[model samples]
Target: SQQGEEDPQALSIQEGENATMNCSYKTSINNLQWYRQNSGRGLVHLILIRSNEREKHSGRLRVTLDTSKKSSSLLITASRAADTASYFCATDFKETSGSRLTFGEGTQLTVNP
Candidate 1:
């Protein structure tokens, strides 16, 4: 079963702007991580914020989590054309599920040059 999925399949942005996306899950989880994949680049880990945490920030990226709602949000500040890529959210399930980062379909982001 799909554990986590991001909202809005795609997003287009200007050279210098902020973009936000949300992710929702189906069951209780151990932790959730966000990743970014360029058009032809490997998916790189962006952040990993646990269920117990509410929010986290790294550089221009801000992430928020709401365990009660089984949801999370990612905010990218000062967008650039290089930021154009697909973003995905993944989660580590409970003990019985094993340690696997199940990723979502992803949200395609376009930053116009």
Candidate 2:
């Protein structure tokens, strides 16, 4: 119902496998960002991709943004048990008032060793 809403709500995977989470937004965004949060911990910024960029990478994490579809995706390669956390997608909107950031519910990723 909000600007940024993620799909699959939850994910289960092996330690060596990969995990992917998708987010869809309603309005145009200046940029999109992904964040990770361990249980009972504060969120950590994962990556950020501007509207002009199609894809970006940081270590084992890859992010892709599609402006036409108003969607973005995050892929974690060689996921580990330590990577088990909640991943959220945030959209940055530059409005007449100012910039606004909206976060999705997030996808709970459980990595089994």
Candidate 3:
């Protein structure tokens, strides 16, 4: 079953502009991870923010988690055309269910050059 739901089904932006994506989840999570996919192919791990972590950053990506609200947000700074891709939030609830990862529908981001 899907656990995460991303806000704003799609986004379009010009190169150099920042892009922000939000995700909401239904239940408690151990860790929330972000990934980037190109052309609907393999996903590249962007970052993973644990339930104990309120925020984390990697390179140009910044992620914030609010367990109280059961939500998370990702921000990409200095967006480029190469950054155009689908972003997904995934969570593993091994504490409740067996080891299985549930993913969000994803947010398709378009960065125009």
Best by TM-score: 2
lDDT (tens digit, per residue) of candidate 1 on 28-102: 888999999987789999999998899999999999999999999999999988889999999887666567778
> What ordering of candidates by lDDT runs from best to worst?
2, 3, 1
Q: lDDT of candidate 1?
A: 0.91
Task: For candidate 2, list the clashing residue pairs, or say none.
Answer: none
lDDT score for candidate 2 against the true structure:
0.94
Q: Score each candidate by Cα lDDT.
A: 0.91, 0.94, 0.92
Q: What is the clash count for each candidate, in the order shown?
A: 0, 0, 0
- Candidate 3 Cα deviation (angstroms), residue 79: 0.1
* Candidate 1 TM-score versus the reference: 0.94
Judged by lDDT relative to the true structure, which candidate is superior, 1 or 3?
3
> What TM-score quantifies how close candidate 2 is to the native fold?
0.96
- Name the better of 1 and 2 by lDDT: 2
Better of 2 and 3 by lDDT: 2
